[model samples]
Target: MAKRLLFIFMVFILGDIYFFQAFTTVFHTPFLHNAYWCIDLSLLIGVATLIFFQRQGKDIQRQAGDLITFFLIVFIPKLVALPILLTEDLLRMARGFPPRNIYLSEFVLICAALIVLVIAFGLTRGRHYYRVRKEILSFPDLPDAFDGFKITQISDIHSGSLSDVDGVRKGIALANAQNSDLLLFTGDLVNNKAAEMEAWISDFTLLKAPFGKFSVLGNHDYGDYTRWDNAELKASNLDRLKEIHQEMGFKLLLNESIKIQNKGASIALIGVENWGKGGFHQYGDLGKATSALPAESFKILMSHDPSHWDRVTLTHDQHVHLTLAGHTHGMQFGIELFGFKWSPIQYFYEQWAGLYQKQGKYLYVNRGFGYHGLKGRIGVWPEITVITLKKSVS
Candidate 1:
């Protein structure tokens, strides 16, 4: 970790130097000069802060420090490179271009200013805004009793990262206001410890649905990432987390299936433990969970990571009509506009967010209800997804 940090620090310094040099060659204005210097100074100070925190210890303070340094380490270089690359594109368009230094400088400065505004907005308003996304899905196998059934799915609360109690309460209120028939939490109720959820248990417990609330374990729930005193303690922490879900009135499903009956019609709600692809935990057993269920039952699955959908659920013997998952969190950054959605995580996760259909099987990956490492969102805002199941018209 120390070596990695040092490498990042060196990269940051070099990138800052390159940006400063490039900007100075273009514009010699006193204001532009001072601003670039200030940015360089800030980058140096950020590196120093990271070293201090990392050397001192790893705690909430260190996590917060990492978040601060990450933004600079990741974005500062991109901000610098963007303009240089833009100038390269411009030069390619014309032969014997006289190197439009002034225009390049102005454009870079404008872009820098825009970045500041965007960061400020993302830190302030973006983290607090919870966008409620409603999706209506039609399935030929959906039972008539479940037709028009409204289900609300929220994932990756990461309660350990939340600092605003009122903001969370408001999000909870927004979810309850939907009046969905079933409430489902795909996973990651807490970051690492069950204690992180103590404060918000009351608020989350208020989430009501006639059919009931169901949830499954997420990668973070097992306390695998955190160092524990002993194996028993880690197991105890996971046990307590599962207990907390029950307290929140959620049926914590672990390789289990339950029947939801209404008006003599029935559907299976299967919950599997975290089963991710490549490096993530693979504790969920789809075969074991569905072993006793009737083969023809209309099934809805809750698996925390969407990778499972592609890896196993799609080709499973039993037809799972719809699967709910949330893990990528859309990398908490991306562009989502009308009919256009793209995130870097997409390259890593096929079903990162929103709904996807393949060979009649549907997967809906929630954007998550809370922030994670960065502690703030950009274009990919926190989400509360409401899905209505509609019976296909035939």
Candidate 2:
């Protein structure tokens, strides 16, 4: 199983690089005008899927051919559309119609395509956010201690989504408006460097939580994806990110738990390093973090990936009453309106958005505070989670 999993991971990584290059190459080219406007995302996804099947020891040559065909279909026109999207400088270089308007109208078309790309990219990114939120659990077993607790959770802000400083400020402002008793961030504060959030630290500082503000690292926080070329610099990046969290008045939780007390009522909250059960980050020691808590205590686990619920929380002997996670962004495409919610990412994830309760355990996966791929949100807007925990009153 592990070997198969690794192979699939390799296929996914390779397929991603191949398709991304194919698309970028087309986008930067001046030719390949034979593409169409009636394109759908399924073509590319199908190709990606074929790669998965090939890795699973199904068929490779057929899948590879399909991928090539899909590549040709998307690659050519994307390049064809690029010049049309650009200004006359590069526009004249391509063979578009009506000279300047060719470029202008094509540019408009590209912008429209961008809107679709945002939806698609956001949807893809949103896959990780699929966590069935926990039910407002009632711990009447005699906690008489902490009731009516409100914990605010947000994740995957991917701060790079903003163009200027206020964009980051605005995202924080929205999250702060929730007035949560305990405000928690699950990780991915900045897309790259710790200093990238330098200008926005004060904004995070504006978040007011009576109990306290706490956070953990996400996959991006470790600086693992870059050309680090050195272990020291990468380690420093993670360390500085921790410092930034502390500067924002957040108690950085790393493979550890802290008991928060209110009105003489105390509950344990634990957070760990980035843990992804999927093809992502390392799983934090859920058992080790919770080892210090009383076996009977009402515990809330704060690992970044909701998949941890399935991996550890659900079947564990130490009943974790609630788990808060937010790596998935709800694929940034689903519609949640007027009592209805749906997204394409749901097919890949069992709990894509909202609250979910299974086998006496709960996980709340926040949709996140900012966009990742494109700056726009369609059906799934940037989220502000306001969870009020009250007695079941049952």
Candidate 3:
């Protein structure tokens, strides 16, 4: 752990040294230089302090979140400037002389400034900038009576991280405005403790849909990240979280399936506990969830992590036409514009954000309904997904 911290410190120092060149070249004022170094040094100290507190197991959730947000605000712009300055240095070395471009430093500064503006907005307003993403999934086997059924999905609420009650109220109001036939929450209702959701219970209860609201657990819902006095305490916290779901009018599905029927036609909604790839816990049982369902049932599944779709759901004997998920949170950062989407989380989970289809199965991974560790969202804003189910005609 010490070695890892040292390595991280060295990397930050190196990056600071490399990025300082652009600042020096672009700004002639000594005061500006002093301010820049002061911020950097303070961030370095904060990082060290945060690590120490974390190692000591102190409750530094808010501090850690703030430090991460500040560090990224400082680090990302400098990171953007690195390649620009490096390109100029490479040209100088290749020619064995000073680079001809006099405006390169200024250009790098401008780019960094723009990035700072974006990051600032993300920290201030983007955390609650809920975007409603709509998708119309057509399935040949869909029940005709259920065609045009609208489903609203919001995942990774992380109520513990939410500070702006009005922001959350607006987001919930927006979800209600969608008038989705069914509402589904895909987990992470709190960061760690069930008590974190106490304040927002009323706000969430406002989310309405004609077909009723349902949910499934995510990895964070298990209280796995925090220390408990005993096994029973941790278990009790989880039990309370489940009750909280009910208090908010959500029918929490552990590893079960229920039918949503209309006009004598029905579709099966199967929900499982958090089942993720890599080191995440595997509490979900796909077989148990779908065990009694007919093979021909048009199934819509609610699983927390998108990886479950790739690792388990796709090949399961029971065919699930659509799966809704939200664990990745698109890393709460990334670029998604012009019909192209990319987030660092994609490297870990193939179906990180938005909609993905494979072998006739559809999965929509919500970017998340709330922010967590970083306390803000970058390009990947919080999402409320509305999916309309349509029957495909031959």
Candidate 4:
């Protein structure tokens, strides 16, 4: 068992190395020029701490202290990240975008990912729950048809890393404050197993949307990253996670459709299994999923991958009007300050975060509510998107 765990750990660490090398090759220049350098320092601290953790005795308390520090290491960079995202001045005044080929922006995304690796290392070492950061996302102009659409969106929760339901109550409170019209969870509900949510099953029930609550799957939800000797067991775990969703007042939408109707005005919510350019998520079949929607009316897709908007969705399909995604997690890093948007993850995801429109189609890539791999949220604090369906006013 230990050997398997170690092998998994090595695989992840090596993947990080490859990511860094590939990123540098593309950008070929120093990152961000100024603020980007901080991540470089964070990386150095990460390397030194990793070696320290490996050498430490397996004593639980000593290990616990290390876990806390691991959280800190992951958490601090986000303070830098927050300034870049929320502060109006920082983003607007910031100069330069990532160079196209080898874009330095990607490096920023890669560095953001490193924080997760560090946290996952802690979890692999039996560490969990360093801290849970609470974030509120209030969107502009919620449609009158859906006024007070207090939708609670929890994305990239990565439940396996959660030691306990630390911020669960606070998060619920935040969600309730908006008097949410609906609650939409954008995927990554569990890190790996269905059992992980056991500790906090009751907590999620606290979140109730007047209309209803819904959930989708994330990359980690499939448990593909782990080596499962029995495919049946893996499949069973997924089924169980669905059961958990049902238990928590959520309707798990897997390549299915639902109707949100109020005062006779209705919008169709179409959910397909995760779909990405590569085989990241393969179950999304728009043809089959949208079969429920009539030839007309608006349809919003809850697909985990943003690429689906470009690769498969934006056709004259007419059935799909909006795509809501969250897998990129804004690379969980970057600055949106000073009226300038900068994040390395953007190169891979043109619609990495916030509202985007193209070819008359629309997409809202959420920043996510819960932090993944890492313990803290930086520039792109987890978001709860409130989308208002506006008339073209044409």
Against the reference, the lDDT scores of all candidates come to 0.84, 0.67, 0.89, 0.64
Best by lDDT: 3
Clashes of each: 0, 13, 0, 22
Query: Candidate 3's residue-wise lDDT over 64-111, tens digit each?
Result: 888888888887877777666677778789889563354877787788
**Once superposed on the true structure, which residue ranges of model 1 sit more than 4 Å away at CA?**
1-22, 25-65, 68-85, 88-99
Query: Which candidate wins on TM-score?
Result: 3
Question: Per-residue lDDT tens digits of candidate 4, residues 187-224?
Answer: 88876678878877888888878889888888778877
- lDDT for 37 (candidate 3): 92
**Cα distance off (Å), candidate 4, residue 43:** 8.1
Could you tell which candidate, 1 or 4, scores higher by TM-score? Answer: 1
State the RMSD for candidate 4.
12.4
Q: Write the per-residue lDDT of candidate 2 for residues 108-146, one digit (tens) a residue.
A: 456546755644543444323222233355655426656
Give the winner by lDDT: 1 or 2.
Answer: 1
What is the C-alpha local distance difference test score of candidate 1? 0.84
TM-score to true structure, per model: 0.87, 0.67, 0.93, 0.65
lDDT comparing candidate 3 with the true structure = 0.89
lDDT of 2 at 321: 78
* Models ranked on TM-score: 3, 1, 2, 4
